[model samples]
Target: MIVCVAIVGHQNNPLYIQSFTEGDDALKLHHVVHCSLDVVDERVNNPKKSGPMLNETYLGLLYPTENYKVYGYLTNTKVKFILVTTDLDIKDADVRNFFRKFHAAYVDAVSNPFHVPGKKITSKTFAERISTIVKAFGLSSAG
Candidate 1:
């Protein structure tokens, strides 16, 4: 199941974060997402190992934790979508599906005239859509 989600800007700064697990672990989850940036950077610079980075926007697995596995997707504009889940053996196609939906939601969020680029997303529509998407992964907000 997806336990946490984050949208980060090109500068490595977090724009939004949502967690499906209870407690004050959002901070910890943020660190987890932040650390994954290095992996994204590695793949970005060494694109060959990951195939044609220009065509394949999905960066796939960023890293795995004892309790969760992190997946990352990069946009041409340098924005990033990071997802953390307990499902260690998730398929690449499934991750791609998640990112495809997420990218659309992200685009919708940023396209809003009221939205300020690189800022936290506060759109209820975006949040609701994400809540539904996360439901497919089996959750919304934990506590």
Candidate 2:
């Protein structure tokens, strides 16, 4: 199951971060997400280390810890989306699907006239959509 989701800016500043699991591990999850940023940097900086096309937004599995697997997606605008899940064997298609939906939600959230770029996302509607998406994760087959 997804334990955490994060949106970070190009400067490594967090825009949004949420943890679904109920426990004291929110800090741990946050640390894990933070550490994954370096991996994302490495992958983006050294394209030869990654197998996929350089232009692809999906960076695939960033790394796996004893209990969580982290995935990353990079936008053309240099925004980064991070996903942390306990399901270590999750399918690539599922992760891709999550990013696609999440990115759309992010775009919609930022499109608001009052939203300032680089500011934290505070839209309640966006939060609700993210909650819905997280709850529906892995329930349907990805195309």
- Candidate with top TM-score is 2
Total clashing pairs in model 1: 0
Colliding pairs, model 1: none
Clashes in each model (backbone N, CA, C under 3 Å)?
Answer: 0, 0
Report lDDT (Cα) of residue 30, candidate 1: 78
Global CA lDDT of candidate 1, please? 0.84
lDDT of 2: 0.92
Compose the digit string of candidate 2's lDDT tens values, residues 22-58: 8889999999999999999998888885445877999
Q: Write the per-residue lDDT of candidate 1 for residues 1-143, one digit (tens) a residue.
A: 88898888989878878998877788888788888999999888877663355557788888898888999999989998999988756668777888899999889889999999878899999999997888875532322
Highest lDDT: give the candidate number. 2
